[model samples]
Target: MMRFDNIIIGMALSLILCGVTIGAERFPPPDFVETDHVIPSPTVPGPRQDIYEYIDAVVLLAALGLSSYLVLRRRSRRAIFVLMVFSLLYFGFWRKGCVCSVGAVQNIVLSIFDRDYTVPITVAVFFLLPLVFALFFGRVFCAAVCPLGAIQDLVLLRPISVPNWLESGLRLFAYVYLAAAVLFAATGSAFVICRYDPFVAFFRLSGNLNILIIGACLLVISVFIGRPYCRFICPYGVLLRQLSRLSKWRVTITPDECIQCRLCEDSCPFGAIKKPTTDWPTTEYSRSKKRLAILILLLPVLMFLCGWASSGLKTVTSRMHATVRLAERIYLEDTGKVEGTTDASLAFRATGKEQKELYADASNIRAEFKLGGWFFGGFVGLVIGLKLIAVSVWRKRTDYEAGRAGCLACGRCFQYCPKEHERLKKIKEARAKY
Candidate 1:
């Protein structure tokens, strides 16, 4: 397994270097040609692009199915690793990271809220298929089919465990990111998730320099931190985690009864394994009950406070919209607070649009932001309150088990279990007898 991991890492590094070299050559320094009245031509996609998107959706479904089998039935970490490599090649490199589930979240939200927007069937499939699989099979998609996760998984050289408190705190950012992405998409303000996708730069081998730097930094951190982006930042991961908690089938550490060898306890790098817990002491249990009661009472207060605070930031958040920023710029110019007019302002003026109308439109957008902010803040507050409640509560467990929500189903612990090896050896011996 270690050798295979090293080989995959080598191949991935080679591909990255090759992609960078090719990208640098393909996109040389731009030659600025001074010209007057340059006509802009709109480019149209051929049938191939649409066909490719359909193929991508089909491939994604197939990959998810195979990954589920590998993790849940075959119990083959090697097979899962192979699938991860294939996903990185197909979804990451060939697709250039477009039509991806992460970005499709925005498209789906926009389609639902904006009547004029129509989501393509392929994008809908990309968005929904993995979630459906997650509801039944746990996060097999995260284990083997997500190129973003695959890339990070391959680069993980020496992962150190993150403290439980810090890990829990960082996970809150994923929920916040999910809320913000939905808010921006529902309001037709932006696709902030796609715009800041760090791995997309690595996949496409071309992007804004700042984003490229951020991607590089993340990869560097991933060397010591397993799936930093997936665990702490990816909004899509937040959805998967929730669905996986309710999954019907999940990866298990042992094929039979656990022997309490403790080998599998430290095998997982993502801290997904839950150790057996004893009953809480009488004093501690009483104290926890009181704390839970207090937190329950505080939940409503936190929600309202967060909602009010978020709603107050409408003026700042609404500026993310083009119309809002343009209106603000035009207003500054009109009021003589600024000296020169921007191209956008000049274009608006040329359109002969009424300032009154522009201001009204901006006002409506700000109103939407205000409403969305309240929901977003309330959602975040609710998550925080629930998290606090969960920590305050204790559960009794007799055996070490994989966390339903936290496990990536990577099959790392399977190899660490002597029972699993014995089961395999017995099966092999039975096959020989047959």
Candidate 2:
């Protein structure tokens, strides 16, 4: 087993070097001077081959299916880890992390908002398969299939537990990120999620120096803290967390019944194992009810304030649009606030477009941002309000169970359960008798 593991590591390292060479050859920067006046293409460096795209879709389907089987039916952590390594190599190093399910979300949202945009079938498939699986089998995708998650799981050498309160607080960023990604995509402004993806740089073995540094930092943090990105930074994880709550079949720490051994108490690095609850004091319960009522009454007020405040920032948000940026740059230049012309500004001047017309277009885009900001901020406020209420409320459980929304179904706790060891022993004895 050690030899086999060494072979996999060696192969992945070799591919990393090869991917770097290929990345350098394929993604040379543009020669034109950088400027904000020109529209940026949404395209990223992905595979151009139609055959490869189809192959990727097929492989993704197979991996998700196998992951479900391994986690649910076989209940084998070794198998899951092997498959996770394969997925990291195939999707991360070889495929360069493009056309991923995480980024496919922008394509889906853009298709809904823009009439002219037609999402490719492969992209749609990549986006939906994990969601469908999460609805039925919990987060099998996050267990072993996602290249991003797999890479992080690999770097977790000395895992530490995050306080549940801190975990809940940090997860608010993912909600905000999802809202911003959707708002930007709906307005055709940007794919902010894809643009700032930290791990993609590691996968492709080359990227912006700033992004590479960020990716390295994340990996270093992951060694001590388990999957900070998945828990707090992944936008797609927000969707999966909701869906997994409604899943039909989910990961259980014990194969049979819970014996309350407490052996698996510290098994989960993500703090996903819930301890059996004790009854709360009557006074505590009464206080919680009062707090809940107050928060329920306070929810709409928070929403309104957040919405009103966010709408006021339309000017800043709208600057993400090329026309708005060009208008700002032209105004600065016209007022003698800045020096020379950029390639984009020179190109726009050659087109004989009036500055007033550009400003009008920018103004219209800001008007759109005004409404989007409302929804974005209101959604954030709603999430916060609901989170407060949930934290105040307490649920009762008699047995230690896995958190439906928080568990990655990684099978780490399986080895810690004595019941599991007993089950394996019985099976071995039965096989010997047969």
Candidate 3:
């Protein structure tokens, strides 16, 4: 069976690699001469790029299906790891990290808020496929298909477990990131996620120097920490975590059942396993009850305080938008508080537009941020408050179980489970008799 599985993995890898090889040869970079005309933003794919996008979408769908089967049914970490490599090569490097599902999130949000925005069919498919798969098959996308996660997973050499409390606290940043990404995209401020994507420099092979440094740092951290970006920072993973909780199928450490053998306890580098729990002492329960109640009462107050605080950052936050930045630049120039005009200011002047119109547009953008800030900060507070409440509650468990929301479904724990080995042994014996 092991030989059979290896043969299967090898064949699949060959097929994927063959496709990648053909694609690389077929789509050499365009030889356009550089002129003064500004290069168009890739919001919409061109004729050749459109063909690549469709191909990418098809590959994404196939990879997700294969990933789900490998994680949930095969329970083969080796197979999953093989698929992960192909995904990293095809989606991350070969594709140059454009038209990715992660960045497509902003396109979806922009379309939702702006009537004029139209999401490309391929981009829309890229965004929705993994989420739909996640609803049915847990985070198999994270397990073996997401190039970002695959890169981190491959570099994980000496795994260090982050403390669970610290991990939960750190995860709040993802919620904040998601909210901020939505706010910026919705208001045409920016796609901050794509702009600041820490791993993209490595994927595209060239990018902002600071961004490349950041990506390098993250890769270095991944060597010891095991997918820090996926666990603590991925805004898309934040969505996947929630949807995975309601998945119809999920990865389990043991094929049959958990036997509390303790071997698998330390297997997961991500620290996603939850040990069995005993009832809390009555005294502990009483204090916990009081704490829970206090947290519940504080939730509303936290939301209000956070919203007000965020609203106060409207001026700073709104500056992220081009119109707002231009307004400020114009104001500085008019007041003689700074140097000569920039190319942008000169361009605006060239348009013969009145200063008031720019200010009014900036003001409207600021207002949008003001409202968005409230929602963003209020969401942060709400998440924080819920985290506190969740910690205060205790649940009884008799068997070691994977955390539904936290598990990446990487199948790393399977090898440590004696029950899993037993199941495999039985399958081998049955096959031998046949």
Q: Pick the candidate with the highest TM-score.
A: 1
lDDT of each: 0.91, 0.91, 0.90
lDDT for model 3, please.
0.90
In order of TM-score, best first, we have 1, 3, 2
lDDT, candidate 1, 1-434, per-residue tens = 37898887886787686776433454454555884555668998665667777788889999999999999888988999999999998999988887788889999999989999999899899899999999999999899999999999999989899988999999999999999999999989999999999999899999999999999999999999899999999999999999999999998899879878888998889999999888787878778888999999999889888888888899999988999999999999999999998999999998899999999999999999999999989999999999998899898888778999999988888999999999889989999998
What C-alpha lDDT, on a 0 to 100 scale, does residue 88 get in candidate 1?
A: 92
lDDT by residue (tens digit), candidate 3, 223-285: 999899999999999899999999999888888877788898888999999899977778797
When superposed on Cα atoms, how far off is each prediction in RMSD?
Answer: 14.6, 14.8, 16.3
Worst 10 residues of 2 by lDDT: 21-30
Clashes of 2: 0
Question: TM-score for model 3?
Answer: 0.88
lDDT of 2 by residue, 279-363 (tens): 8768798888899999999999989888888889999999888888888888888899999987878878878999989889889
User: What's the CA error at residue 219 for candidate 1, in Å?
Assistant: 0.5
Q: By how many angstroms RMSD does model 2 differ from the true structure?
A: 14.8
